[model samples]
Target: MTPSLSRMIAQAAGRLTFPVKWFTYGRRFRYEQPQKGRGREFFQWDIDILGTDSFAADAEIISIAASFYKKLGLTPQEVKIKINDRKFLQEKLSAMGIDPDLTLPLIKVIDKRSKVTPDNFNTMLTDAGLGTEKVSSLLNILDDKDGYKNSEWLTGILNIIKQYGFDDYVEFDPGIVRGLDYYTRTVFEGWDVKGEFRSIWGGGRYDNLTQDVGASQTIPGVGFAMGDMVMEEVLKKCGKFPALTVNKTRVLVTVFSPELFDKSIELSNILRRENTLTELYPDPRTKLERQLKYAARKGIPYVAIIGPEEMEKGLVTLKNMSNGEQKMLQKEQVVKQLI
Candidate 1:
């Protein structure tokens, strides 16, 4: 299993008050066979808010996750966040006369419903101590899209999520009984609409975890963790990966020769003062052609050459790498062209 930041958060909760919010990003390690989107080590981002049991907290966290996906250029058509409440499911199961002892097992079986065939799922439910009739009733409940109407908690949370303007990206799914047992209410998972990969992210409200971690008092919390690998796969499949430049340096200032290195530095500084990204060649001994090649490979769009001829006239030769056009311009003119 992947390491949890909740335990560490619990340790820190002792000194804090309610409604605490914290986020962490760091490398995570696991010992498991790697696959297309699964790895032994990856970066994960965790965001959690503790000390409130209100449905608003749950809705806020879910909205945060949805907003993150939207910011990454993922649309409701490309991905959706499935949500469910454990307590709501439990109520439905009890109303259906399912044994309290079988609740946990039934939820676990439900979690695997999509992974197994219909026959295998029915068999698994029966093996978990549900009779044929109970299994049939359970399946009907899971398939009911209006089941959330029966739970005031679900209704309130959904309404709050709508207020956050992410209702289109969120939906109720009874089958999303997140695999972790610590989840107490409002469980959620983000999945590609095509169902082409594992969940991009998952979390829910875990009110008792802080107490379990030896806290003197219960600190209700809701959070989610998104791994870099699965997210990358989704972004790739949806053609959402941004076209990022290889480097931030937008201009390369070539040193005409060892004697003109100072001129190159002055030009770089002038461009920088105008908020232009500039890189100066460190080795003046290098040939001008080699410097140009370096800038080309680094994706720098413009290059400034301060050769003896241009220096004599107090001007610069600005070369446009894209069209190979060159212009002789003063320092002020060079800054204007860049900015």
Candidate 2:
């Protein structure tokens, strides 16, 4: 999924209030090769907290994902949220005598460690300018299970997550240096516990993102994006997929005859203006029996029939398709009852 930073840059000019929480879900297109859980075009859900640099912002952004997983019947045993701090890893790299300029490129390499062979991973490090001994040291550091305890910021964020009762779903992973260079701290990914799929979601804090994008003001932000493709796969595998319905038309207005077509259209428009989902029979010449059968097949709950008699009285025959009940009421009264 495309990161939200690109979208937030346009909002920088507005100078929104601090501690802004934004959520959006939409279609995203990518140029990468498609594979399992990966597609060229997909839907993504992005949740972001911006304009605050507090460590609490990091915890809150993470908690949003944890809460969502729990709501979807995904337990801690089925998923884990891996977290790491770039600033913490940067210190380790600097301590190993690596040049400051190479840290970003090195992180890019580390991000791919899971997708490559161990030999290839070492080769990548040396190719990035690390000496043999330095590569050994870096690998040792990455393998350290307790490395996160050394960073106060990392520990603080983890503890905050603990307070939110999601400790089981989160843990520190030293190898999780996200591929993006703009992330200043707190990179995280949601993954299936079985490791059978790509990351379910990923994001981190980008404190300098707005400035990096050429905005006059600096807007600190932390967020994550979840792709629908992988999420749906996970739900089906876990047998938690919910039944969904496609038909949304709540009312169908039938044109009883060619002469009463205008009245049917007018009633349809009126119902729509009242914020109701309405479908008007397109063929004015269609018989009433065919129209009723169409609505029944489409599962429309209600039908409003406008005929010569009903039009003369300024009323509509509202039929409850579910129970085969009909009532004659004024148009206003019908609209109120339908709502």
Candidate 3:
């Protein structure tokens, strides 16, 4: 599941990921509750740039997710991109004397605030050994509905996104952690702003992840993961699905009679030679009305009928379904008629 999702994401972004890291990680597994898009065993998308740390890297990842949603037909209004920096979260946690490691799990818990009651969340904080002061401060930061109270880090990130021309779909959200232990910088999430699902796609910076395993130097990188289920739901709900169709095949050759089957095949070959899509009716037992009706219903624009008379004249009768028009046509003339 993970490899499939990882490959899909790579293709969407016109990139590829090597599988050597999976072997290095020992192919770990963890359980998650099964729901509409969750499962006990599931896909995880990971991406990084081994040497970049510019805010542009962060913005680029966010834009990458946004572009994916755009391709899926989700309107800009229906999608909202949210970002928060792990550095900023660490600083905020540190200011309250809460150990960032201890607080990291709490961040994952707090991420579920929408699913749990306020009383339950508070009890959770108490159980996690958070003092009343730290709890109060954290709750206040989370509940700051108005814009003025937001910290400068958030404002600066937002400003940079605007400079990058990606602010239209971006928002500063304090609650987006991406829940992993390795995120050390900017994190981004895409929300179906008005939908039932909580998040559509999310990713963040993990400068220390590669180094944690073996690499000596730190590698700063950013990327996100998108779930097909949530994205397809959002796209369908918003009517963004493009038409699923195939190349147009306009001409079908009808088998007028068993004796005339060879003539129909010849006419079809001529149409093909002229570069017009042509189908030779497989069975001569069907009625002319049924065969022609099949062509019309299947969106074939032209049907060629070569009976004994037309075969004698070295011509065919081209039936245009659009206006119920029919004309005797030479093999050279059928291509222009269909086109």
> By TM-score, who's the top model here?
1
Taking the tens digit of each residue's C-alpha lDDT, what string does model 1 give over 61-93? 999999998999999999999999998898888
For 1-339, candidate 3 gives per-residue lDDT tens digits of 333333333433334343212211122244766677554544444443434666666665666666656666666688898777767777777878887578778877777776678999888888887888878988987665443235564566567667766677887777677777777777777887775777777777766665555545444556665555556666677788677767478788999989999888887787788787778889998989999889978888888998889988988898888898899988888888777
lDDT of 3: 0.70
Off by over 4 Å in 3: 1-51, 68-73, 144-160, 163-165, 212-219, 239-293, 304-317, 329-339
> CA lDDT of each candidate?
0.88, 0.88, 0.70
Q: Model 3: how far is 87 from its true place, Å?
A: 1.9
Pairs with backbone N, CA or C atoms under 3 Å apart (clashes), candidate 1: none
Would you list the clashing residue pairs of candidate 2? none
Q: Which stretches of candidate 2 lie over 4 Å from their true place?
A: 1-14, 129-133, 258-278, 301-339
Task: Report RMSD (Å) for each prediction in the order shown.
Answer: 2.5, 3.7, 6.5
Clashes of each: 0, 0, 0
